[model samples]
Target: MLTNKSSSSSARLTFWLGLVGLPIGIVAGFLAGASPLLLCLALIVGAALLWFFTSFEQAVIGLLILRSSLDLFSGLQLPSAFAIGINALTILYVVVALLTGKAVHTDKFWWFFVGWVMMQSLWVILLPLGGLGMGAAFLPSAIKVWMRYFSWLMIYLLVMQLKDRVPPEKLVSLLLLSLVAPISVALMQIFLPASILPSLLTAQAKAGSNVSGTLGFPNGLGIFLTMFIALIWWKLSTSQKRLPWMILLGLVSFVFVRTGYFTGIGAVFLLILFINSTKITPIRVIGVVLFCSAFVYMFGSTEFGQQRLTEIYQTPLLNPNIDISRAIILSYGDGNSFNWRLAHWNYLIEAWKQFPILGYGLDSSPVLGIKDFRTGSGFAPHNDYLRFLVEQGIVGLLGFVLFLTVQGVHLVNLLRSSPPKSDRRNLCLLLLALFVANLASMLSSNIVDATTFFLYWWTLVAIAGWGNEYWQTHRLTQSA
Candidate 1:
């Protein structure tokens, strides 16, 4: 009876919306002399927005899927004012929930990050008043950069809140289901000749120059894949329908091999060794590791991988090398290479010393530019550690440290409380492994604000976080 009533209401609402919207749209289109395509797109977007606002559950699920997939039009050159994304939508959702008095929850890591962003904002806001030469013009860009992390906190909290409303398995299932689009694109990249496809959609030479799917670059795509695979690892542990997951697992693994990101391999290696304690034995671990290593060696060692390995293994002789610090001064030309990054990092450290405690204000590191060997150009810091110290100073670094510290607590809590081979315990292990891989990757990659990667990563974090509390309370009380 309720279902029928809901259906009847939805039907009437849609009918009214179409009736009202169609005439307004036609009039606007006619007045503006708009094309059919433009009008149609507007209508579709309008309908989607209406649906998104009207239905909370479906809206959140759709947002997850869309975030995992593409803003297929993202690469297009558009005005900043026209931009809309998961980050923007998150703020809107939270605001509406608050205004409507809808209940929400936050987790352990939320306030620390929010507090940090607030502090960072202070640095940005104060720099102008402090006569730092940088104007308030930078505040907008700083907020934009800040939004990525802010959304990350919201996503983690939102998922933790959703635990009671949605089943844990279903949440994991949503993540698994999110894999289809990227996987299909990856498979397409493998079979199709690269000459025909858009370069923007593919990986670089180091990553086989074929597959990145919807993700714009190799490392970002690799990170997302590693995170999602870790989520699947949690689900696979206790699934009765093992064959389907195993099949999906095989495909993701095959694609991971094709990704050719060194980190992905290392991440999988970690998972194989320590996914769950009860399921782990020295002999079994050794066997599986060897098998995977052997298979990867046989299948994953493409021409690019071999050549890349040779390059990395060969030592540089600065005496006769192009990469040698020939000039005492570094220029923008000395960019993107490993030596370039080192030179740039040294420069940032020196510049950071000028404003050591508060640093050169927020977002001030890169714009310091290639002032001899004193700073990098308008490029990412490439090392998040340096980015924190140089940009947000000690406060930023401490906030980041505090955020990671909470993860460590959760890791210890889950590992000790939940038994080996159990769902919650395995999930705990996967989150820690993924977090380690991400941190290690951060040593060389400016992945702190990698949007697509975090969309998947925080989902895993949220799941593990919610489980941490639920299992601890239940098990401890029951056992006592």
Candidate 2:
């Protein structure tokens, strides 16, 4: 009887799997105009072909190069199989991080990061307890977004653990070259005709000059341009090929300006402030201030620049002091981007009251109807602060804020301690500028959800934060 029961259970499992797969097989056959068996064979063959060229390490590197260049996570008009591949790859990454124990570092950043992680993890339990009622329908998207956050955390851990394994000079050189493909492609997309490249390389078919570069948005492209430019300058500080790199910098800056986004203004300003690698003296600061003031005055004298400044405001006149808080609150109703933002923010603010402690789960913002319904297609909340407050609630937001605070304090300390005109100081200034720019950009963009952004951001965090110590340790070990 026991043998019979085992056989019956195994048969039932096979039957259920077949029942589930039958529809999928039929759909594949109908869509491809081929037999089900042929479609199945093709899938297996394709997977085999892909597998031959793929490995865990290779996938991660490709993620750096390709993901930095493309917006794979956007889920826009792509194949369903791509999503499956991403999910599988993320699972593999998480497994590796866990098995290596790299995710459990005892650093202060780890404590804050893990606290935020734990809060996100608790969403499954929290979202259903008279809260947003975390539905099964949203699980796939939720998991994907959660995976993105986890991927960032994992990369930070890996960098922290392995910063000593590679030299900065070699890595920077490799990246400077590897990044050329994306930058070149972006240039073509913007300056050349879209017909010049295949559809995979150019999304400008429907929309002329989709300045998204490979990342899928103009601002994203702008962010990328500024980032790589900064990296070039970092390399230039120590590089022998100063003239050629300087020319490249000029060309890239020209492209960045055409992007027409001020997202990197703060970062660019900071970079200009310390471009000489001189000590941070008050005189140096005042000179930069005066120089910027003169430039602004000259620029404002131009007709186009005056018009641009006028367009930035144009919010209807309001009471000067109806109590500062009330005046700010009333400003949200103005007819502009601010109005759209306030609409979603107010909606989110109200929704958070449902579960004040833990608002909703990761990726829950989309389902909350927070997107702009202006053109019938939804829009994302450009602000990261609102994203954290609504999705992670107070605890998650607090943890995130604390992590940022730690980052700020650490960078300030590094700046003060590192020798002026040294590699360490230059790196610190570069990292500090990016940090400030990134924070400012967060006020109106989703810089966090970006893939290459995190890779670039975390690498600096590791290097500027603790990579030097690791480098010193490596040197000592080698010398000994």
Put down candidate 2 lDDT per residue, 1-480, tens digits, no spaces.
977866765676566557857886776768578566777776886575356234543443444455564463355633233434554555554454454332423356655666666656666555545454345555666666666666566666544543444555454455565456656766777667676766665553223533555666656666777677778777655665577876776666655544444445555666666564354566656755764565455435544345445534542334333433443365456434443455566667787777666666767775564544465544556778877777778877887788788878878887776655556666777878777777878887777766566766765666555544543222111100
Of candidate 2, the 10-residue stretch with the lowest lDDT total is 471-480
RMSD of 2: 10.0
Evaluate residue 91 in candidate 2 and report its C-alpha lDDT on the 0 to 100 scale: 52
Q: Candidate 1 residues 1-480, lDDT tens each?
A: 977866765676566667777888677677457577766777776677668677766677666776656633455622122223544656666665564445567655566657665655666667667734356777766666665556666677656556666666566677666777778777778888777767655534354553676665555666777777667655555665657766676677777766656645666676555554345557656757664776478334665455545434322323244443532233245332555566677778877777767666666667764544454337778788888888777766777777677767766675676654456666777777777776777776777756777766777667666654454222211100
TM-score of 2: 0.68
lDDT of 1 at 271: 58
TM-score of each: 0.75, 0.68
Q: What is the lDDT of residue 376 in candidate 1?
A: 31
Error of 1 at 126 (Å): 3.2
Candidate 1 vs. true structure, TM-score:
0.75
Clash totals, every prediction: 0, 1
